[model samples]
Target: MATTAVINGERLWSALMAMAEIGRTPAGGVRRLALSDEDRRARDLLVEWLREAGCAVRVDDLGNIYGRRDGDDAGATAVVCGSHLDTVPTGGRFDGVLGVLAALEAVRAMRDADLRTRRPVEVVCWTNEEGVRFAPAMLASGVVCGRFTVDEAHAARDQDGRTFGEELRR
Candidate 1:
């Protein structure tokens, strides 16, 4: 017989609502462009939530955020999952938020159930997935996967002439 564990939909919905408030627009949408102050606030909120869920959180050199839940075996490779949190100038509330929040919910569910696996679970919040603020989308992942050099990705500038690297440092 197989047992099924139900996801806490209420919790997930509440989280989504809270995140939506970070970069909310008058039209009830999101305006969290890549590396914007709104995006940073959203990232900070996610980091706080990740910490509350007992995840070990860290931000990469390119400003991609990661939350990790350790497993039984320390030497085992991690099982990574996640999506971007950045959005377009006028994106919907759930665009990339769903994936990242879903990953957080999974970790929270596992913690609630006292479930431990052999491999660590990592949730990532990728930076600059939407090219609205910074050209060439998926900049962080591109650097991570060797598709683009860190220098090259960092050099990318927004319409206002602010470099991605500069915004990341702020």
Candidate 2:
């Protein structure tokens, strides 16, 4: 899709609403816990939209998703922008969701306008950001940024004894 036809406020709002619809609580909060079906669905939906906008998408072992726009130089670091898709058990609508969708919307707008930067742009979605399921927050980013080891993240368990590695598989 072209950048001009990409980022529409209506569409963005609709997408946000759609994500909110998953695991919606009576009080207008979302309960899509990390690695749950709802979380996976939301992640998949975002990746689908990213692909539609000509982004090359990849997910790290810990489920840190990256949607990249190809750049002239393959070696350039991406101008990445995004937050997390995972939400708390009683999470508000905006929170980190807006940050993730906004980055995607920006990419769509850029594509529609045929805009290009010296470095490629990436729309990212980090996993388990809220830590509602895994205890500590930013587990994925911690691993990705070298703040923590993959083994350490894998050892993380929820209140129910489920490990982060097992959750990522689901």
Top-lDDT structure, candidate number: 1
Model 1: residue 79 alpha-carbon error in angstroms: 1.1
User: What local lDDT score does residue 10 receive in model 1, on the 0 to 100 scale?
Assistant: 100
Estimate candidate 1's alpha-carbon lDDT, on a 0 to 1 scale: 0.90
Where's the lowest-lDDT run of ten residues in candidate 1?
Answer: 1-10
* Residue 9 lDDT in candidate 1: 100
* TM value for model 2: 0.93
lDDT string, candidate 1, 31-69, tens digits: 999888899999999999999989999998999999999
TM-score of each: 0.95, 0.93
Off by over 4 Å in 2: 1-7
